[model samples]
Target: MSEADGIVYSDVKFTRTKRNTRGTTSSEAEPTYSEVRILKTHPSTELPGSQQHPVSNGGSKVTPERVVIVVLSALLAAAVIALGFTSLDNMHTKQSFQTLRDELEAVKRNLTERHCEVKSYNTVQQTSPQPPVVKENDPCLKCERGWEQDGRQCYYFSIDLLTWSESRDKCRQKGGDLVQIDSRDEQTFLELKVREKMKNDGDMFWIGLTDSEKEGTWLWVNGSPLNERLTFWSASGPDNWAVYNPDGEDCVMMGKKAGAPDLKCWFDEFCKYTRRSICEKPAETGHFTLQCV
Candidate 1:
């Protein structure tokens, strides 16, 4: 017969174990009772000719609950791995953000420093006094209003007549002095200017040259004496004409350059005569070689 797995219920006599008493030294039997397991084969109660499939230990598989538990465990493990990667990515992103913040702060610091430097430079420029700028191409300064510029000199022709001394004071107030005829060019120019303002006969222009210091010794305002050889006398002039004052014709003038009597030459006249005057000075824009004489 084929072996079968089953439980059989049957009554059987129980056995007793023998034991010895410690004091009396008498032999005695101990009663024993227990439930036991036994292997047996049983006949099948199925109908004759019925078909059935045999199952082996290997074929006995896990239940639905156990399968569900295994699946859940696998999903949990995958989720844990994904979470670890996510945590690493988050940590890396935080590090990058911190680095960016630090770089931005550094840039801000640099900008602030640069701004401060610029401000400091501006402050210095504002506090310092700048020297006059000389024009590169010319040694003449720029003429102020009411003055005319020529080469390295600026000229001013006065309309209101004033005494020679008074005219010189006026010119000084205007940042200049009476025109000194240093050359023929200068003399010619003054003659033209005086002619333009004359308006009639006997009108004159006072120059800076004067012999007021002595009877016949002519000196410029700068204390420089005139070169007699270079003198431009009108007709028989520096005759110390005394029509206006016998105190003597001390001041010099360049009269009419044209007319029945030529007047383009120098003539001595009274220093007190009120007449249009010319002012001359070195140009303000560049180095003057004339020493402002």
Candidate 2:
């Protein structure tokens, strides 16, 4: 018998045969016996009268500790993959944010440049000198050939004598009316101009003032009542004097007299009295046409 891994097996057998010890003369021995021995390399190897054992792969047995190690390794690998994806997503997000920031900066720079340009243009416009505007057709120079212009108005001095009514009609035919003196400046101007045209104290020019409607209520020819505060009546006239004729003088005239009070040159007379007249109109403004005689 032999031993292997502390396991051994033995076989014993008995056989009946002719005795051969005497070479052909003696009968077989009374009985013959034979013995056999079996050996095994390890106890786990299956034997005729031994219990079976669990098999192993490549002579290596599996253990619970190794299985746990393998499962843990699988989980770690999955975690690493998930972390990699998360990192990639974070990187992409950061890039997108950076790109947006760059775009915003560019837009801000463009807007700032445009604003500066506009400011510079406005400054140039404000600082540059501009030429003065001159009107092509000045109203001050618009008087006709025969009419005399004075302060935006034109005057026509008549040479023929006529009644007050006839004189007003003639002035209307020339697109004007008898002069209405508004200010002391105008009154002074008329005084100086009439002083140049006077032949004698009796020679006078009929103005557009009358009191023919009532006894003493004077009014301009345009129907507005006279401003009594600005009248230029002589010191001792407008007395409704009835000495010269039965009817009182109701028309007004302007003239220069010797030794007269300063700016006192107005006198009342009959409407039927004939006298030269002074006509007036506003200077042309090109808005409408005035057909003058």
CA RMSD, predictions in order: 26.7, 27.5
Model 1 error, position 181 (Å): 1.3
lDDT of each: 0.71, 0.75
**Candidate 2 on 118-153: residue-level lDDT in tens?**
123344445544422324533222355577766667
After TM-score superposition, the amount by which residue 56's alpha carbon in candidate 2 deviates from its true location, in angstroms, is 99
lDDT of 2 at 143: 51
Give a tens-digit lDDT track for model 1, residues 1-293.
Answer: 44434655555546565545555443455546565657666668998999998867686677999999999999999999999999999999997998899899768645533432112334444564453355554332356668886555889988878999999999899888988777766666666666677777667777889988798999988888998766778776878866667798889876773564333467788888898888888766322211111
Using alpha carbons, what is the TM-score of model 2? 0.49
Determine which window of 10 residues in candidate 1 has minimal summed lDDT: 284-293
**TM-score for each candidate, following the candidate numbering:** 0.49, 0.49
